[model samples]
Target: MNILIVHAHPEAQSFTTALKSTAQQSFEQQGHQVEISDLYMMKFNPVASQDDFTELNQPEYFNYALEQRNALKQNHLAADIEIEIEKVKRADLVIFTFPLYWTSVPAILKGWIDRVFVSGLFYGGKRFYNHGGMAGKKAMLCFTLGGRDYMFGENSIHGPIEQYLSPIQRGTLAYAGFEVLPPFIAYHVPYISQKDRQDILVDFEKYLKHLDELQPLKFPVLENFDEKMQPLN
Candidate 1:
């Protein structure tokens, strides 16, 4: 299987980076082609603007949302999206690895989603989502957290970590026709000792193998579920 690992952490030495490498390495060892797109190290722009939609091939249709996006220009937004779209087009499995921040993805990663998962391209067209253009693709989220595992529980401070990914899971992946797999999370980034991290890596390798073998998730692209995904009158 061809897999794409999208990593968003900044520092290469961070534990999150290590996990990203481990996941990629395991997939390669298993003979699956792996693509690693490092958002920050690549100096990714996480902002979305009309320039993003600009078609060098079709200049006349240059989009106008660029002017409306200046407020977000301070962040590197659209560059990541443009690159990720290409990577997504190449993979069968797309895995997102990052740390949860303020109960959501880091701003840069969020920006990646905001830009690439746009209309017309990823969705919104006649017969756009019969089975979802990318519907047969698979997606997974892997995260490392600074808080204790207990804090992510229903009675704890943050609620379940799974709840944090609802938008990416339901709104993005599912909406785009990808199957959502249970995310792999390591809750106490600061607290996990080297031994624990090692064990997690071992478990992670097992899970990566599982992902390689599993069937892709299926969801058709539809403007609305009530309507048929295919063309209609």
Candidate 2:
């Protein structure tokens, strides 16, 4: 299978990058073709602007999504976005490797999503969730966090980790029609020992080997919803 790993960490020696490396090695060892998009090393621009398009559909007003649609149709999307989109298209699975920032993805990664997951291509009106343009693809998150596993739960200070991840997992990836998998998280990396980190890497390698067995996370399916997107039940 073709796999794409989008890595988003500034420091190459950081544990986050280590995990990214581990994933790449593991996937390659399994005989799968792997591609890496090192956002920081690539100096990927994270900001959205009029500069993304060669020519504007409506020069008077700025609508990013509409412009994306127009650009896609005209094949006028910026070269960088087109390249990333092609990478996504070629991959059967896309792995996002990053360190959790403010309970969300790093800005660069988010920007990658905003620009690459274009309007007419990745998603559009009534074309989200199971019906999205990327319906056949799979997406998974592999991240490191400073928070301890105990620090999050229904009875804990921060509530469930799933709660913090819902926006990215459910709102974005699943909404874009990726069969979202359970995330592989390296918890409390800042406080963990080197041996512990190494153990996590070993465990992660095993996780990657079992990809076919991992059940995708459940999300809303359009079949159960009416035209207005309300549950038909």
Q: Give the best candidate by lDDT.
A: 2
lDDT of 1 by residue, 160-196 (tens): 7667777787767776677778788886878778898
Which residue pairs clash within candidate 2?
Answer: none
Measured by TM-score, how close is model 2 to the native structure?
Answer: 0.96
Model 1 quality (TM-score): 0.78
Question: Against the unseen true structure, what C-alpha lDDT does each candidate score?
Answer: 0.72, 0.93
Lowest summed lDDT across 10 adjacent residues in model 2 is found at 224-233
Query: C-alpha displacement of 131 in model 2, angstroms?
Result: 0.5
**Candidate 1 stretches greater than 4 Å from native:** 55-82, 125-131, 212-233
